[model samples]
Target: MTYPPPGSGYPGPQGPYPPAPPPAPPGPGYGSPHGGGKTNGLAIAAFVTGLLGCFGVVGIILGAISLGQIGRTGDRGRGFAVAGIILSCLWIAAGITIGVIAANSDSSGGSGAAPSATRTKPKEVDAQKMKVGDCINDNTTASAPSTAEPVEVESVKIVPCTSPHDGEVMAVFRLSGLTMPPESQLRQRASDGCKIRTRSRISRDPAANSLANSYYYPTDESWRSGDRSVTCVAVAANEGTKLTRPLAR
Candidate 1:
């Protein structure tokens, strides 16, 4: 093969080649596709709060905000935000339904009559009008009065002893002194005197064994209002039974 002329620049054993271009700059979408965007924090919080069930309204509000942010920012957790909103709505509806049912139940007052087991207010009568051998019914006598506090009598009803009664007035004696004694002393004296009187009346009878003595004394308030009488009563030992006759002779 004849070589090109020496003075004429030409490729012989090696052919002329174009130089390599510099590497292309990294593109905008380079590196990991998942590197930039993150899960919305509010969305995660909303989902957790909804699961807790206590802050349903708050969860709903947070979920709404999270959804808007997620849509604008292209963040993750879209599913989480949606779930939170749904759970919150359901919880709110359930709470309202339960509240309504409770209100209705309370208003209905089940069967429109007071339960027989519950004690109702007894008929009211004047305490001064009470007399010996009279049958009386009182809420205070439904159960044993607490000895720690002065016995309070709201009202009383004088019923016939032949019918069922709570107690019979064994005695209606007035305190001798014009000046009232301290409540503690008065209560003690009244209780002891009434117990003695009741024992004397019932000692000969077999039914006395099934009776318990209880007495009511004037409080400071009542004494100031011109009341000084102490009333004694014998309640049935078996609370379920009612006395058929006057307990005292």
Candidate 2:
């Protein structure tokens, strides 16, 4: 005799199982529950600005905001937010480095005279080392005086003759005597010498005509240190005007 199936009484086979319940409706995709799988708008903005290397600070801010939003709302573009932040930080660092280098280069100077490149860039020059062709920008508060004086100055900003400048060195000469002279006598000597040297230049160059004579003489302190040179400068005839071209031939 044949054994009967346990679930059925003497059954040879069981009916096919009912079709597996239709795949549970696919659950919302990852990061789409509330976000609907859309990329964050701020993330795109951040990436674009960072890639361009402009508005780096703004890009960093936008990336931070997007990252927070993606975490909370489960939106896409998290990678973009992180990349934007990294790129923005790098750009900011690079910009700072360039600025520092430029500042240091502009502030540095050699001893005797500015480099020949002074025609294209600005450089600092020691007052006693100024040469006849040097063009200087006046940053001091005092108005340009027609007469020369014995004023104490450590250095001056030498600029290109093509650029705006307050004065041009017309002459460089040394005063006589081992001892420092009185302030009035020194001033008078400097004024007269500067005027005599610049007379022909003013008559020849119309630009020089519009300028007045000025000078830089060593102070007693500088004098004792063997500073005997005087730099005769041609300044604007009028207080506010500036020289726009080279006064030298």
Best by lDDT: 2
CA displacement after TM-score superposition, residue 107 of candidate 1 (Å): 48
Q: Model 2's lDDT to the true fold?
A: 0.80
Q: What's the number of clashes in each of the models?
A: 0, 0
Candidate 1, residues 1-249, lDDT tens digits: the string is 888788888666566777669999987874343566898999998888888879959989999999999888888888899888888888899999999988897777656655443233344587656677767787564335324345567578877677787777777767778889876788788888887777787675568788877676776787888888877777777765678876545
- How well does each candidate superpose onto the true structure, as a TM-score? 0.45, 0.50
Kindly provide the TM-score of model 1 when superposed on the true structure, using C-alpha atoms.
0.45
Candidate 2: residue pairs that collide: none
Q: What lDDT score belongs to each candidate, Candidate 1 first? A: 0.74, 0.80
Candidate 2 local lDDT, 162-243, one digit each (tens): 7899888888988999988898888888778877887888677866556677888878889999998878888788877888
The best candidate by TM-score is 2
Candidate 1 deviation (Cα RMSD)? 17.9
